[model samples]
Target chain A: MKRNSIIVVLLALVCSLSLVFLSGCATDQTVKSNTIKGDANISTMETAKSKAESVALEEDTLKEAALKAKREQERLMAEAAAFKEKDIHFDFDRYDLTSDARKILGEIASWLSKQNGWEITIQGHCDNRGTGEYNLALGERRAETAKSYLMSLGIAEGRIDTISYGEEMPLDPANNEVAWAKNRRDHFLVVSKK
Target chain B: MRKIIALLIFSVVFWCSSAACGKVYIDINSPAFQKFPLAIPEFKDLGNMKPGENLSAWFADQLSSTLKITGFFKMISQDAFLEDQSRAGITVEEIDFSNWSSIGSDFLVKGGFSYDGKNLAVEFRLFDAIEGKLITGKKYWGKSEDKKAMVLKFADETLLALTGKGGVFDTKIAFVGKEGSSSEIYTINFDGSDPVKVTTYKSLSLSPQWSQDGAKIAFTSYKAGNPDCYVIDVASGTTQKISSFRGLNLPASWSLDGKKILMVLSKDGNEDIYIKHLDSGSLQRLTNDRAIDVSPTWSTDGKKIAFVSNRSGSPQIFVMDSEGKNVRRLTFEGSYNSSPCWSPDGTKIAYEGSSNGCFQIFSVGEDGNNLMQLTFEEGGGESPSWSPDGRYLVFSSKKNDREMVCIINANGSDLRVLPDIKGVKSSHSPSWSQHLNLY
Candidate 1:
């Protein structure tokens, strides 16, 4: 009976020690889960902040693209208007370029330089004073003179084409010096743009 | 007395025989030539069926007008005719020669027609009023719609008998008719009748030249946004692009054999004349000058080419061989000479030269000897195209501020504006076609 009492006391003491160890493990697990939860909350907050920043960045990129496209459109339109702004005139039955004509052609060359992927056509016209056959040749000469001048000014030859109207299509149909001067001209047109 | 009468009769017989032996009745080349007086009585209605359409008066009027347009015949007034219209005869055996000869009729035309509303048979006879001999006779069978054609055929025969050359009655003149900003090719009869629209390309089409066979017309058009050379089949109205070189593709003339076309091209950096072979599609550049070279015309013999060039510090005509060699300058008197046209005989070249601040038609011998100015009108003449017989020229001129097409004799006489083409503001660039074989 004395030995039985001693064994029971030892068993109770061992059971108390095991219960303390299990409680310590459960406290460690609870501490780990709480730490994990806190870390998750921080991660969620960081994710939200990054998402907001990304949305704002995307909007900024889209606005910038729209602004760039608008600018490109405006530039193209301006270039087109400038390219067709004026026509160079010639004297009676003459194909030689004058000083004013040269200046205008120089301006045309500059506009063409900016307009890559575009093509131009130079329509040569003449007054009704000369014969149609001769005027046809004269118109061609005027167009060629302008084209040659433009090519000399660094414009590509392939980008330029020419046609002669030969007094057939006149800007002014009146029979006077003013109308004739206006009719004898080199008109520029934008044939294509890509 | 007997011997003298026999001698006179022998001489008269000789003269009549000579007149019948292909002797031309009219010498039109004479500078002092006078218009031949002609008379035509009302045609006889030989039809046994019911009378129709006043065919007698219509035939007489048609013949008179057709002959008068040649500037060769002076029609005698029907009121002055002594022959009774109701009993007049068409056959030489049944006519009184004194009636025609006394009325100053050197030639007389008698016509008779039988019409059944669906078909018509007509007979015509040309007689020398003095000798009362039938010079030519023709009988035609056709429908009522062929009345004009039959009259034209008889007129051509009469002209052939008198002038030793056929009339251009069946030919057409191709010209550029302009309205607003567009110009198109239009064709009209030689007498300015039956105006036909040839091209419907509502763009600038210029320099129309007829093929030798009259089956096609080659011209330049801006319809494709470039001056491209196109040949249109006249009958079918189908167009084909023959040359579309990057630069000026103006067709000027076709070869005599219809195997080649002469065109002005600027593909080699400037305007130059080049001949394109129709069969091989091979191009042979005939001119290589830095100056403007254009308006090429092929000679009838196909041995030479005449073109206009501004190489001598002014525009002038130039002649070269078919192979593009032996270039010689022509037209030294003018500062501006262009639109070189070779005569059908290849003996003379006609062009427009600037004179007195306006262009006038001028012609020079192929050897450059006879440089004659053919026009001195206030508005001036340009684009001289030769008739098929080489006896007349057709050109464009401005009269009363309106552009009109005019025809003139080769001797620079009888200049008259063709009747106006209706509904067109102006007409220019007239190109005369060869005699079309319509029969």
Candidate 2:
């Protein structure tokens, strides 16, 4: 039974390594495949971008956009929904992502691999201790670490931007170790290319 | 003859306890009292004198100045001396105290110097001519140029031994002066005389602060293309780089013990205060604020630091432990309270604040009590440095794009701008001198 457990552990590591490699290898394939749908995607994305501007946005009398508006909305919602579940969390008080964090980030790398116009921003954060001067730096470093890993997974440098907010913004308000662990993370913010 | 000798002993005893020189300082508020008058004789040169060197005269002048500045002494003229400067068989070796008692001279000052071309030394003897016993004897050593500095040191030591307070003749002032687009370091006398340019090369340097012992000065320089901290030996002119970080290196303070310097750096993408050890290049980050933290000044005991931070929507003064713990905001009366310089006595902190829509110098108690305004002009004021005696402060004010140096009393009296000497560009960042051991 111990021998079986050893084989299972090896199998799990191999699966993780393959997942990393596959996520990386799929970018070239996706880009080439994405080119076939480029013209239609641009037109549909433009229509969706305008309608998604705001609820008060006036109608531009976009004859073509009006016709494709409903399908464009569906495409964007599907695209944004695909990334909602991918949260890149980290170990307590550190910027390096955990094993579970790597798994989630691998899914993000795969999602980014399926597109060409992604301009993702990684905002690093930290649990506060010193003066405001230091936390800003810690936040930036955390964000850069995540961006670098994404780049190593075949995400182009030009498509990734990093900024540190230090301990300014937090999704969790509890002032405890668990909350700090959750706050010390790189939250992905996607800005589509012009 | 017995009556004359008794009067002479009384005068000698009076001079022994009075000023080193003729000038004296008296507060108008203090009750007026009769001063003990004294005669200053041209010191007799007992040893072979070098050409162009008057060791006796220098000693006399130094002694006179020390005594005079203290609000005592009605010093008799050097011409009234019963002797001459020429050591040509002078009667100094055969002086009698009874003669001075008859002349109504309450006290007498006399000394001499000896130089063997290879070794320069000064020997002085202070006598209570009335009691007929020597009060104090001092000897000093230095080169011709350092003779004055050494004599001042000796005088200061002797004065402290007598009065229990240090002398002020040997202290120096470290100030920042800009030339064209760049700034340089300079030092001057405590009375703001004889400005000596310390930093000749142009690299936009400012904030010249002395170590606790006044041997080394640390300031920020951009010569290496980024702001980094550098220390310069005042006597040797040797320079050493302290912090070579990637960006934003503004040295803000020195540790109370002068073992480390506190500075701001942006190597980690945020400006934070870092303490750099002088002996070892080891550094410790003290602040992690998401906002800008710059300008750190140490407390007297080295346990805590007062610094400026913009984390509270606007810049304000804050205090933290030496290890960067227990952060607390210290100012709420101003929109901006920065450039905090702690007084030597550690009772108050003089800083620049912009509460009245213009930056002005202000002082507040360390526990955040008794807010006092020190300066208020059309342009504004900043960079307050306390003198060694904690009686005076030197600061800088904005004129146009440049600044000018100004010195004021600790309680905010006698506010005046330093004279615009040649080669003075923009003047800012003043550090006052500690009392020199000038005797």
Candidate 3:
């Protein structure tokens, strides 16, 4: 019975030692979790402050930003509208310049002569006629014809680049004479400006 | 031992029972052809692989549909078949011909496939059901990924055995499709299945023409902000720019030997045709005319070239020697004629021209004597490319506010859309391929 009591005391010592080690590990985990919670609280406070500040400035910032965006949009629209207003039209299946086309191009030449440090891309278009392959070449010929006239009016050759749309993209997606006339035109777009 | 003896006795009995039935030679060229009643049962998977049934059915469906489109065979409905499965009979010694004969099938095609985890081996046999004898049998072995190619190989052989020449069923058709506001290149099989995307350059790609070997395709793409000529390998999907001149590098045609590519470059301020030596990248300018000279097509013999030129004040078809000599205009009636495609047999040229007020497909002889219009619908047809067999033409038709590819008989009788092709609602500029031995 004395030997049994001694054995029980040793078992109790081992159990107590294991409990101490386990509790030590649990304490360390608790300290780490508390540190994480503290960091989360700081972050939440910072985010709340930022959120409050943004809410306080929302009305004035939004109105000012909207007004500035509208003005910039209008400026871009006016610039694009200027180029669209002066598109040179062509007759059906013909690339030669008409008297009216020549006159409009003369006005365009004067306007181009006044501008500086700007490059224009001459997009040749076709009126949904003929094969895509043939129309492509024909459209290039049209753009070349226009570019040569511009060169004759003293516009730098480097300022003009040409491309052909070949009945793929159209100004009006209609199958009528009026739309075809509008589509068969040399559209001008400002590609680069100082 | 007992099973072997029983099998031998059964085979001998069936052989003697089905010996003599008259043979019939079908003339596919006959205007009023009685389609041969053909039955294709589901293929069997001898190895019992997981996807055996699915692959077998897929191959059988491809074969049946190809045979049906030949216009010479009446593919009997599978429901009319007495044997729902092939029953492991790939050899003449094992087949019970009476079972097929009783079902009223004139010809029968049965096949079996074995998948060994890494590779597939398919065997096909064409039998005269009435005569109870095999006409031809073939076996194809390849990687599992090449299952379609193996099936096509068998189909090609079967077609050759039936008709004196094989069909272009295994070939691909390259065309342009409108995707997300940009045009890209796409390829589809002749049977109208497996539409593969060939290009993703989100720009305008047009006029895709296949090389003579059917290995590469040359087309024009505005990828680098200029219309440049590019060649793409069909198998690897790798693209290389062939020409990037100052203006207009458009693909025109590929020579029969694939050593020369003809294109139109406007570098000289006028669109003119030039031949580029593919190996050395040397160029030979063919036309120096002030008028527009474009859309060049080479004859099958590579001795002559047919093209479109506006030398006559309007676009018309013209022919010249390979070296740009002996030029002759071919078409005079049409106000606008372009896109000339030479037939494979070197007998005729098919082109598109304005008729009345719309473009129509026309076929003219080599000497420019007979000019016959092939399409008459209000919807115009353009880009008439010939099949490898020279018996059909595939072109694009803009009818009823829809753009689709149309395949028509060379004689202009049968007009139909590609049966199972999808995403073709906005496809155009089709080019048919030759009989390629890719597999």
Candidate 4:
């Protein structure tokens, strides 16, 4: 009779251990599936633990998306900056495009052609030597000349716009020839990008 | 003594006959014209109110300065006066004329005022000091704030009595006042009293053109990220974008009938002159040239338009009929001539011409004769606009690296810079308004 009681107690210990092991597996499954379904409900302790794990996984996903979007915005801004860094200059009181101006405009046209949904505005500027009104019209001619060149290079006309700031907004405010050479030019600005 | 009295009577009759036939005491158009010497003493306190602001001297100074700006009268020194000014009579019947005559004062202005802190009543008398007779007199009742207006009105009457034409005291000069990167439209009195900001666009506003009726101001602004032409009502402060073409919509002038505006537009891939009807919003292309055309100004009679174009290899002034035919180049001397402003009489056009690497103001007859250079300053002059009476031209000039508003007679005499307004760094593109009917 004593031997029979010992065997019965050992069997009871084995059964309780297996039940604990089975619940452990069940909790692991619930955590994985709850991450997908966004619902965690089971035993009280298991529910709480699975909810925490699912919240962490969602946070990771959101952080990854935000990082991707930020990177894209930075890339576009860099591209626009690169496009606007170069300016094509003109002679004093003249708007005809020089050979150097044409070469630079060709490069701009190529870049703009590669850009899928980008648009740019060409700001024509002038030196402060002439009357403001006449310089205004001269600046317009400079911008229009640039626009026509870009269009000739297969860039869509709708992708280009022009404005003449006259002598009002000079890149260099000095009253010398060096500053004037820098002031009278066509400056590019990216208005839109995909 | 009887012979002296007879001579006095004869001279009085002579003066009366000349004045009755509208004889001008000063012929401002003559190249050898002289400034009329005038004397102004401290105003007498007729009301004897408690002294606060010393308005007796203040009113006298205001009247003196107002007359001084017309370039017509010269103020005599008070120290040179032989009379006891403090106790002198303001009327013709009570004073001695020999005191002013000995001082070589051709005219005398005497004022009496009563100020009770807020309201003011003033009396002014302009005298022919040589003849010892009153020429004109005025009495005004107004608030203290209207003191300037009152003084200006009396000065206007005095000018009429002297020149047979009124002064531009009630007129305002609209100009582009630049602070930093931004520019706005501002209006100052012809005498430089009130500086009012007409635009708060916070962007680049240029070339303010006042309408004929003094009710609206048209200009070009980059407010909406584009250079668009807009008109603002002077009374309501309401703005309307009249032209928003794809590129380059600049206002040049307004029609006398207030029904249309002349502007330069570049929608045709080239800058050209265009007229926009205010009622129908329909545009009439005035010039369809391939060259750059800008700065269109209408004649007073509305029969012609003056503009600047580069079709002749350099920018020059050209005149065309109102319908854009009969285009004639008016300037052949300057390689770069622009900013053509038609005179009030429609006989001449004033413009800025480049000379010795600097710009100068010049006026040429409509028939392309008698080219006269108006300004010879080293800093140069530009953007000339005529006064209502056609006696003066207001333009922008630089002095000591500071941009200022300057006035010169049509004959290139009496070049004076208007006093600068505090905190204003630069002012340009002055458009003198028509005579404002204000009391």
Candidate 5:
């Protein structure tokens, strides 16, 4: 009787095993644990990347503002330098530097001496009594005179360029003497060298 | 004694032409001046003149052309008078002004030339046809070429005595003749002898006017890309652009005082007249009209200006104060009238008039009355400038096979063509010089 009972239990256990296999029921512990680990690693990496990017952007904006402020300060300084009184003049049909003109040019020479890497242009003008060609020649002479004067005062020769405007770009249009006096002048402009 | 002096002053006022001192003056506005039928007695030649070198005959041709083109005199045929050479220089001895008057002439022009080694002295005398007296006389001492110049000056003097202003015969005129696309500015003797090139820019140039002092010429040149007003020194050949604005710049008349340049500028969006200070380069806007106001010419006295505008949809002449105040319309006739030039005497203004699709030279009084058409037919005239004496006008026109420079009398009589250097398609704008050679 004991042997028959043991045999019936064994068969029942076999039937249950077959039925579970046929239904394809199984649980994967390694896959579920691997998915959970994968999700945690991805979120942690994304958070770190966003924090680094935000810090870099903030640093870039701070650097940009500091550069702009420095540039504004330099512009204001240049304006103050140019604002001092300057009176460049010429003789009749001559570009030769007079004592008075050189005195005014002396101030420019000292100012230019302070700043390195600054290139400048000297523009000459003339009155309207003579022919246009003659006035142009005269203007060129005047500009060169100023340029040479600046060079004589120990300024580097390559630092200054000269140009002539002739009578066309007059500072005054009056036909009287006062207007002509104002028209015959040389002005300066700042430029960058190549 | 006081009564006698008062009577003398009264007679002086009553008979002005008859009033004589060491010099006798003729009435400039003499009523009979419609053309004093002057008899230029076949100018007598002095002995042994070389063939084709009959200087006096050349003088007669020049003088006849000068007077006849003036619309003032009919050169009565010289066939009625005798020609003698041996006694001609000293023998004005035979000219009977009464005989000329009897021949239906109102004046007499006679010339005598004497060569005394170093210089040839030519003397000329103009006679009053009715007053029966020598109105004025002059003597010139120079070379053969100088003698021609002398004769022209004498013609001018005669015209001046008759009209109270210098003749344009001695003045120089500048014009542009374009053959194909190439153009050049040429200056010719009023009789058109030396049609010499003033500018050979190889580009377009136009609107030339002499400076008030006659030392420089202001014109528009395209040599620098666009049209800009350039002033060239007459003697030095130096060029300078006075009005090289960003847009079109053209010369009008120079101010009478020789201080400012009155020209047209389109820099302010539309073309307007601007008075540019020559020295200070200051520009003062003169007119604010939205219409295209161009071709500004100052009045002779410098009080007003006249220019062309299309504000009414058709081009007409308008006059305004020099400061651009109180503008008024001057031409109610014709659709296209432009390039107005005031007479030197300030009596009339000459402009090219277009009507029925053709252009003609027309003159109108400053009062806008007496509008007379001074040209006829087709291929019309442009840029009519008055001779210094206001008797003749120089304008560009087509004659024969090509376009040539023609001088028409203000009365529209005796249209004569200036010498066009073998009669080629040459000449136009002809800004007459302001009476040079006074020195």
Candidate 6:
């Protein structure tokens, strides 16, 4: 029984060694080319992905700066637009400006100084107190007086135009004193802006 | 003193024209005139006239209406006549003055008409009813279709016999009539008989001043979108622009000889009066005041021009020589006065002045004395136009919130709304024409 056991152990050791050696040889010949090609493809894919990410980040930064500049310009334009909303008033049967008119005109002059490439038209009006023909002339004088005042300021004369509406286009169509006060005025209209 | 001499001459002529003159029915110089009671019998239709459509009645009706328009005669009805006369009895021998005198008629008119298909013959006689004598007689021959002309001629002759001057019943009035939102130029007879639209511009028009000969009208219109002055021939409706100077081109007055037109032009950036010669198109600037000067009117002799100016801080009447020399302000009392029209006789100027915020018509002597108020009523009166005879004034009146054309006697009596105009409720800026005498 002892002699049979020794022989079996030797046979087992020999079979194990033969199997290990055969498997090692097969791995060396067939798996060598595929593993190196696979490693090269993975490294090239990683470099291309990193370069694309870097270009996308740089474009986002430039877009952000351009948006900031456009927003600033719009804010300045909105401020200059506010000066066109007010009108100058006059007294009854008179083309001379009241104190209130001069105050309003000064504000307009300051705002116009900051704006470039802007032109305005000044329309002179009158209350229904005199003859139509005479009122026309009176209204013209009123507009010219206003233009002269603007010229005394830094505003350019060529940027202003004048027209007289007489009593035809009244701001207030009533014949009473309160309405006439409102109707006798110099109205401003923006003709062009760049 | 000169007026008294004129009355004396009129009285002598009146007494010499009639055989038995005693008292005058109407005193021409009186402030409030007394209307004469005048009798007009039916016009007799002679043979072959056929009297179609009551032709005889039409003739008598026209004559009576024309006489009443003068505002000097009160027509006595036919029912009040003492005797009925036929065409054969139109002679002096057949008319018995006592018959008319009994009816309180100071004057009588008898006429006859015969129309023979193509031609018409009309005979009329004016008589001083209490004198038993014929003052004047006339015979007219015209086409049968021209019966209206014959009737108007006879009426003119009757007025000439009584007043030593023909009536203005043949005259016309040109005014601004509103159509929709725009105003147009219109012409109507003196008694408001026929209203004819002279302009179809369908735009704002104003200040329609008739030429002295009544052949054309000068007005301002906005057809070309500017207040431009235009002259239109009344007969042919042909229009020609006289002034289109980039601004207000308002007509002020036409010269008495029809040789020139004075207008207000604002082309030089200010209002100034300008005279434009019709034949040569030459323009002359008359005033250079920096203040407003407008609405120029010429005197009877055409040697002077009166205009409205605000040089004294308010609009007032100013008179200057024809060449713009010798400038004199004529009004000192009012803060506002406009529309100064010189009287045809060169003795007075009628204008509109505001009193207590009510505009009324006033007349002042040429030398700025004898200021007389011609109208007083609710609303206000403006644009006073004088008759050619200087006996009546027609103006625009605003009463009851409606605009109306009114005619008042020069003495401020007999104020009445001009009759037969449609939609006169909004009419303004009346301009009376010279005696047309179209017939």
- The number of the candidate with the highest TM-score is 1
Note the residue pairs that clash in candidate 5: A172-B280, A173-B280, A173-B281, A173-B282, B35-B72
- Candidate 6's C-alpha runs over 4 A off are A1-194, B1-27, B77-79, B82-88, B419-425
Better of 1 and 3 by DockQ: 1
List the candidates' TM-scores in order: 0.86, 0.53, 0.75, 0.84, 0.60, 0.74
Give model 5's TM-score versus the native structure: 0.60
TM-score for the first chain in candidate 3 comes to 0.57
Candidate 5: regions farther than 4 A off? A1-194, B1-34, B41-58, B82-106, B127-135, B398-402, B422-426
lDDT for each residue of candidate 3 in B1-439, tens digit (9 for 90 to 100): 0011111111222221112222235556566756678888878777857652467687789788777765567787888877636454656777677777888898888887876775567777778888877766666666666666666666666666666566777677888886535788888877777788888887888889999889899999888988999999988888899999888898878887788999999998899999999999999999999888888999999999999888888889999999999999888887888889999899899999888878889999999988889998677798899999987888987754445787877777667676434543477789999876444
Q: Provide the lDDT at B346 for model 6.
A: 98
lDDT of 6 by residue, B1-439 (tens): 0011111011222223522333233465486657877888888776676544557777788889877877778899988887856423877777778889998998888888776676677777778888777776777766666666666766776666676566787788888776545778888887777788899877778778999998889998878876788999998999999999866788878887898999888888778999999899989999998888888899999999988988998889999999999999999887888889999999999998888777788999999999988888675677888999888898887644345678887887777776635643356688999987667
lDDT of 3 at B131: 84
The sequence of per-residue lDDT tens digits that candidate 5 reaches over residues B198-219 is 6779776766788777677888
| Each model's lDDT | 0.84, 0.67, 0.79, 0.85, 0.69, 0.77
Cα error, residue B111 of model 5, in Å, equals 3.7
Tell me the tens digit of each residue's lDDT in model 6 across A1-194: 89789778878777777766777777775577667887788888888888788777767776777677566556655654555457788875577778888887787677667665666777778875555455666777788778888879888988877766666566655546787788788888754465
DockQ of 3: 0.23
What is the DockQ (computed on Cα atoms) for candidate 2? 0.01
> Which is the winner by DockQ between candidate 5 and candidate 6?
6
Number of the candidate with higher DockQ, 2 or 6: 6
lDDT of 4 by residue, B104-176 (tens): 9988888887866656777787888999987777777666667777787778877777888888877889998
Q: Note the clash tally of each candidate.
A: 0, 33, 0, 0, 5, 0
Per-candidate RMSD vs. true structure? 7.5, 23.9, 21.2, 9.1, 22.9, 10.2
Recovery fraction of native interface contacts for candidate 5: 0.00
Error of 3 at B140 (Å): 4.4
What fraction of the reference structure's interface contacts does model 1 contain?
0.44
Q: What value does the lDDT take at residue B282 in candidate 4?
A: 96
Could you tell me which 10 consecutive residues in candidate 1 chain B have the lowest summed lDDT?
B1-10
State the lDDT at A4 in candidate 2.
98
Among these predictions, the greatest DockQ belongs to: 1
lDDT of 1 by residue, B1-439 (tens): 0011111011121122323577897699898899989998888888753544678889999999989888898999998999886876877778998999998998999988886665677888888999987888777777666778888888987888888777888788898888767888988888878888899888888888999877789998989988899999988899989998877899999887888999898888788989999899999988888998999999999999999888988888999999999999978996888898999999999899989778899999999999999988887898999988888899988764357889988888878787776667778898899878754
